[model samples]
Target chain A: MEYRRSLLEVRDLHVEVEGKEVIRGLDLVLHRGEKLALMGPNGSGKSSLSMALMGHPGYKIKRGAIVLDGNDITGLSPDRRAKVGLFLAMQNPVVVQGLSVTNFLRAILKAKRGEEVPIREFREMLVKAMGLLEMERSFAARYVNDGFSGGEKKKLELLQMTLLNPKVAVVDEIDSGLDVDALKIVAEGINRVASEESAFLLITHYRRILDYIRPDGVAVLMEGRIVASGGPELINQIDRQGYDWLAVKTA
Target chain B: MNVPTPPLELAQEPEELKNIRRKAWNVYTQAPFPDRASTLWRFSSPEAFWIIPENISSMLERGKITYKLEAPNGLLLSDLQQAVSDESVPVGALVGPEFGKFEALNLALWERGAYLRIPERAKIDQPVVLRKHVSGEGLVLDRSLIHVAREASLTIVEVLEGELTGNGNGYLNAVKEVLVEEGAALTLVEIDLTRGTTRAFVTARHSIGSNAELKWVLARFGEGVLKANLGACLSGQGAKSEISGAVFGFGQGKSDIHTFHDHVEKRTFSNIVLRVVLQDRARSAYTGLIRIGTNASYSEAFQENQNLLLSGDVRAESIPELEILTDEVQCKHGVTVGPVEEELLFYLMSRGVPREDAVRLLVAGFLEPVLGHIPGDFREPLDGRVAHSIKPATEVENVL
Candidate 1:
């Protein structure tokens, strides 16, 4: 008997933006229901990798294969990628006026299922999600990300991640601009949504978000390539020793 | 051309600007120049006043002018020519009956059950509308006078659809009045459709009562030319007024928007946003102004005009001004003319919205702020019409 498993295999991915090569060839893999933390310094292409995987038009994938659920999605659209259970909670979500928060959520759900859910059932699920995120009902009436505080926006993104229940989520700097209290809420939101059924690739510059996520695998990215791969304690070591492990490179 | 007057009830005396009418008409004559100037004109092309022949009676034919309601028995569109029954025989015995042409036009177009005499003191419902369709190169005009009684509410939608179905040019001259009694509220949505050389002049006058809410929304479409005018007076204290507009055109088409908000009493408020998109050598101009009078205090007025140039050949001009007599006020004005944000375009395209859908979404987002001014009843048509106006922007990139 074979056990069901989930995996995201990025074999030699090259990403470009505005014709400039940004993320040079890189390779990494996350197994079913596993968590991978991608840490990098500023401008090291951590966010670009995540964006390219989500099919952001801003970044072009010149080469490489992104296989999720046994299918190569190297050239898929962002929405198409999202439909296949790929999610990206951007550090700064676009503030779209006149488009209510409930609207985007409903649209994503419909796009994924190709059908709308019963209003009552959807509302019930939404209520539970909001309650867990400690969000007020009035927030639902407002436009998507419009005039919301940075922390509020993160919570809302987390709520969406939970509701959509995607197979893979690449979060870019989820802990930025959050207070200690807000950070705790956001981390908890991520924890609540993450399950044994899905895998997550958490990208960040700081080690704070890892406090709650507890990545099953840790990868350090330097100059567009993965420099090291280890377990959770490697985060504590990196935070204290700082990538001196780069000089004693092993092929 | 003569018709009877429906006795206008007057409480406050009219302050005649008789001496200034010449200046107004003279200013109206200097046009075709690029940069829109003057707060009174508000981002409007000064050259637009003469886009159509001033002498329209000589060119129009009765046979070509006809209208019908899509939803039979719901509303019938009668030829406004039939309402004026006497005199004013231009095309001498038109395709329809002889009456006040404006009346006949309204009657023919809205002849069905929607005679909805608005009750004073009622809350305005969503989807407020008054739609009029014109299918000829003849002189098309619509005139409506409504009074929302003290504490009452009302909404009106007027749509000008040109179906000359030929290269023949059409002209539309329209005037509408909204009399909001003390504490009354009113929202009016007006649409101007110009296709194949169609040209039109539309003027609207609104009087907002004390503590009343008035939202004025206008949509300018078609590859034709249009000059839309809106003026409002906040007569009662605490009255608030909103004026919003959008004009989308291509292929040598031109559109102009002129708006004026007059704050007469204390605590009067005004806000406006006019969005324009031009392509294929088309041009759009906006001229707007906010006037705060001496007696007005605590007045707040905001104005912004934004134009998206899709191509280098497309030209967009904007002028926004503010005149405040009382120093105690919060007033600001902004004008922006540029192409769509490249980041936004790339973002949407990355999502597989298609480059065209991406442009459409960006343009639609620019117009989203105006949806608030539209009453619920007119939302569907308003949204539909706006979505169609989001033309590709690259053809008008050089427009500025």
Candidate 2:
């Protein structure tokens, strides 16, 4: 049997925001098309780790390195990193007024792809992605994330993932503000992307999203470090028992 | 370039109207030009004031005036001469003979103007567009009288544009008088996109009757200096007026807009919303006042001004004043001046948009709500101008 090689490796990563360190010494490895569910309690630095991986300007990588496909992208700008096949779905999406959804999506896609896609091809892909995420057709004309409901925002994030088709995705808290139906739709979209080509670092506090997108592995995050990593059974233990056992083990 | 001397020839008016012009000329000569100490001119620079040029004949030699009128059957649209000569016209009803320095200068030096009178109960479906262009480097004085009769409805859109003819300085002084009778409505949009080192003084004095409504939108994007003053008197009960303005300054441009709302009777309502965006070394100031008279009970007035400073060199000031003398009145004013939110920029950049593109998007978004208040036809052009104004500043290669 052939084995796929690793696409992304986070080695002993330490990150800070506004001079305060939040993510301390973390390591993770993922191959192409693999999905890893990152579970942790509140303030466990799950979102910060995702941001630091995506090269968010607010995050200061004090130590360690982010290697993507044998290249260290730790010092790359956010846009440069995105062009090199990285995507981040923010936990709290910011609203950009006057920029329509279609225009923003097309611009980012152009920046990532290094060329403008034909209008017909772009529209087709956008329409298909919106359909997959259960977003209304009229949403294309609305401003980016402006006055959007929580579920709609998550759906937009998923739609972006489908259109961009990045090599690696760090989705932060995609299931927190979503209803059951929306959660299922979002999960399905992520799963489809993972199955196609992209590897995902799914950040979530609850295990509900795992029901739809079956993770190949589960990693328990506590105090900015991965306390334990195992197969899918770790989620079952987490669901029945909770994070207390993992906390005790880490302590 | 010789400056223009005032007291130009009158275009054949009645004796009474001619006397009014003479009085206005006297006022123009007697009153001193506004200095920095004046309350109305505090934020405005004294050096930017241009005297009325003496080259009136040169201005007439260049045939740069263009007027077009499209109205319903009952509406009367003609030149100012015909309207003032007609017996039924009220010559000095809305704007008095001598209102201010600019008004006096406009009435005295103005040779021709547009006269629009909508008959009682008549409704004009499409807006009447009045576009003016000034080509030469002298003073161009113009005036307009708009009267929406009882129960009538009308919309007038005025666009003033001109180029600097000789030494890169053009002067345009305009006065607009509007009267909305009982149950009538009027919507006026004034867009100034004149280029060059021009100075524009545009003032609109309007009076609203009982149950009447007035919607005014002003967008000042001239390349030079501008002072725009708008005043509305809610003279009758239930009179309402809403005024929205979008002002942009770039490079060395300077713009100031002053608005006043007077609630003279009971149950009157007025709202003022103005947004200014500046970059580079440009400067802009906005002053708004809402006054509720003693008899204006149950009246409501709101004023809000927001300014977006895209660069550190840009300057903006917003001052909202309110005076309430009556009980049971709702009056409030708000002012905000700041740069774009960094978090919003960070969010857009994370989506693969470059830093410049993100700043451009944020600026557009910042002015979206104000631009939305204008007509849909203006959305594209105004947005384009707004985009161009901030292009240079946002194009910096440094993304940090």
Q: Candidate 2 lDDT, tens digit per residue, A1-251?
A: 55888889999999999998888899999888789999998999998898888887789999999998777999997877777788898888887877789888888888777788899999999888888787889999999888999998988887887887888998899998889998888888887888646688888888888888888898989899999999999998988898898898878
lDDT of 2 by residue, B1-400 (tens): 2223646555557777777777777766667676677556888764454453454456545534555665545455588866777655665566655677667767766767888877899887877777777666666677888888999887887777666455644666778888999999998887777776677777788999999999998887645878877899999999999998877787688888889999999999999988888877789988888999999999999998988887788889877888899899998889899877777766776678777777777777777666666667756777777766666444233444
* Best-fitting candidate, scored by TM-score: 2
Q: C-alpha displacement of B272 in model 2, angstroms?
A: 1.6
CA displacement after TM-score superposition, residue B340 of candidate 1 (Å)? 4.0
What is the TM-score of each predicted model, taking all chains together? 0.74, 0.92
Which candidate number would show the highest DockQ if scored against the true structure? Answer: 2
